[model samples]
Target chain A: MNLIPVKTRILQKNENLFLFFIEYAEKNINRVIQENSVLVISSKIVAVSQNRIMNILDIENKESVELFRKAVIDEADEILVDKNKFFLTVKNGVVIANAGIDKSNSKTGEIILWPENIQEFADIFSEKIKKKYALKNFGVVISDSRVTMRRRGTVGVALNWSGFWGVKDERGTKDLFGRKLEVSTVNIADNLVSAAEILMGQAAECIPFVIIQNLDSGLFTNIQQTHKSAEISQEEDLFQISSN
Target chain B: MNLIPVKTRILQKNENLFLFFIEYAEKNINRVIQENSVLVISSKIVAVSQNRIMNILDIENKESVELFRKAVIDEADEILVDKNKFFLTVKNGVVIANAGIDKSNSKTGEIILWPENIQEFADIFSEKIKKKYALKNFGVVISDSRVTMRRRGTVGVALNWSGFWGVKDERGTKDLFGRKLEVSTVNIADNLVSAAEILMGQAAECIPFVIIQNLDSGLFTNIQQTHKSAEISQEEDLFQISSN
Candidate 1:
């Protein structure tokens, strides 16, 4: 697998994401965007396309920090960390800092919020792009980066995906010695999101779009056109903190 | 980055891992292993090198479940979940299932333990391979795979890295608008490990080693040869469950 980062000019709020992609990748990606390729765009860009951005002060008539508190409470399904420093909260069934309301790479005092309806948009974008390129097989992943517990620096999580299956159920699959494999599924897009996250720097690199070429063609769904991510309950999540 | 999975015959217990790599790659990789490239090897292989494999029945001469329970208690820094389904435990200050004790992809009735001394082994292995190729700069990553919370499929984690810095501290860096970036650092090796993980499957593919070629040369350390991964305490962790 090869992670190819595409540099683009800063995306404006409410810009048509498909048109914007063509404007930047039109002549460049035709030759490189082949079947079995995955197009990874940062969740920040998806939020920008949905106009889910606002000045921190505009969240409410209060200081930036206080306004951020209100916003996190509103966006979060459950607020993990209440206040003081940044807020640690649960949004859309995932744990992320400050509800994925990013302040970096934006105008000072402005914060970009995560897109509300993710899977629906991912499906639409994948359809439009595949139709434009006339490709039969392709995948799209909207990715977000977060700080993992007890791990330094940050790691990536796929917020949502479209055009392919997210996980491969290998529950009854046999191991080398014909014993049933313990781990059930293979997360096809999660690994790809991490690879692309390296190139999609959070600061001034302006590389929010990445093209992952040459992933195993087998991982791509048989043109199923699904726009969903796997849902795991807290009971199934081994890493969940019981405090929630 | 191109993750080229190298298929080798199943590594035997107590086998010298460096020798095994050269035996499989000596004639093939010299031309392709250039400066500023990283080689990712499975932690399972690292354990096999350290002779960490044992029959589940061997521990205290008990049943496999009782043996594994004893092993988890022995290996874990803290036991998160005692028993019932599988042990969710903390090892070396990170949350993992069964103390990173893997039973899949191994011989029938056998279990593989994570190498006891990881950073030391990563440094030595990287140095030996670099010397064999006579290259100035090369990195090695001892990798493990685990399921992320609420995320389907397992993601790769870098147990330890050698010949390069693991995380880039960008705390003081400025974003696009010259505002200080919110996130302090970027986890460099974490992303590369994920790229390599997809090719290094846990089943009969027998691809435990992957050569990650064309990672940005700038990410490689300037020959400091440090082998420590950054540490994060629970208080500093945003996602930490208070229950821990």
Candidate 2:
């Protein structure tokens, strides 16, 4: 599989994402959109398209540290760690620092919020691409850059997905040695999102749109059933239990 | 950037890893081995080459679950969660399930251990490749599949890396609006490993090696300075503190 980058100029807040994708697809004449291709899009672009940006200067007065903490608590679903230096919080099923509100890469004194209606917009974007490209089996994954709990730096995470079956259940399947496989469900969406980051990049790469071509046929599905393994409940989360 | 798969036949226990890479590189004439290109390898192959397979029958009787738990505890540096159904543990600095001992891809009744001398062997591999390809700047990353704390499914993690600088420090860098950036160190090796999985695959694809070409000049370094962000102390860990 090859991760083809569709280069675009810097996207401003509330830009038309669907229009940008179409324009780039039209301009990249050398790269053809094939059937069974998965278009991995950075969620930052989606968030930007939805105008999910906030001006940090508008709030917090001059006490940036205290107000930022208060803002995080308000936005977060649950606060996991409340250290004097930083806090780890849970938001929209993912445990993130500061409720996923990012300040880097945004306008000065402003923060970028995650897209509000992720799945709805992903479905609409998927439909627009399918119609325009005339492809039967295609997948759209909205990816965001996230830092892992114990690991440093940022890797791509699938915030929402459409037009693909996200999980590959290998519970009953046999391994190479014919041993019954256990805990073998493959998280296809997030891995694809991580692959998209090869082109999207963390800094000012400005190439948020990534096209992943030549995926297996079984990977495609409608938006309703695409996010099955995106989030897991806290009770069933071993890592969460271990943390507490 | 592009991820190109290097195909090889199913490798048996204690197979020569260096030989396999050299032979595969020789056969794939279509793809050029460029300078500053990264060779992303799955850690499983490295462990296999190191004769790290352990037969379950040799260790314990018919009580498979009990024996596996014992093995995991023995292998782990610290056990984080010891639930009846599962065990999440930390080994060598990273928190992982079952101490990262994998069973699915190995022979029947056998489990594969992570490479004992990961960094040392990675350096050797990097040196061998640089000489063979006559490349001034190149990188080698040994990658493994890992599940996140809250998220479902497996994503690629960089087990060890060599022949390149692994972290991109952007702590004092300016964002788009010239605001000072924080937590801006990009885990370059891990992201590259995740991108390699776009072709290396999780199952019996037998494509253990992936070649990435056309990286920035600043990314490459000597093996002595390759791995910088592989481990973190528990006290300074925000995620660990949250768990406490």
Q: Pick the candidate with the highest DockQ.
A: 1
DockQ each: 0.67, 0.57
DockQ of 1: 0.67
Give residue B65's lDDT in candidate 2 (0 to 100): 64
* Model 2 chain A: lowest-lDDT 10 consecutive positions: A58-67
Model 1 agreement with the true structure over A163-226: per-residue lDDT tens digits: 7767766778787777788665767677778888878877888887888888777777745433
The per-model lDDT (C-alpha) reads 0.76, 0.74
Off by over 4 Å in 1: A26-30, A58-62, A222-229, B26-30, B58-62, B222-228, B242-244
- Deviation in angstroms for B144 in model 1? 0.4
How well is each residue in B75-191 modelled by candidate 1, as lDDT tens digits? 887776654547777676566788899877777778888887787787888888788778777899888876666666777888778887788778778887787765668777777
Indicate the residue-level lDDT of A229 in model 1: 48
Clashing pairs in 1: none
Query: For candidate 2, what is the TM-score?
Result: 0.91
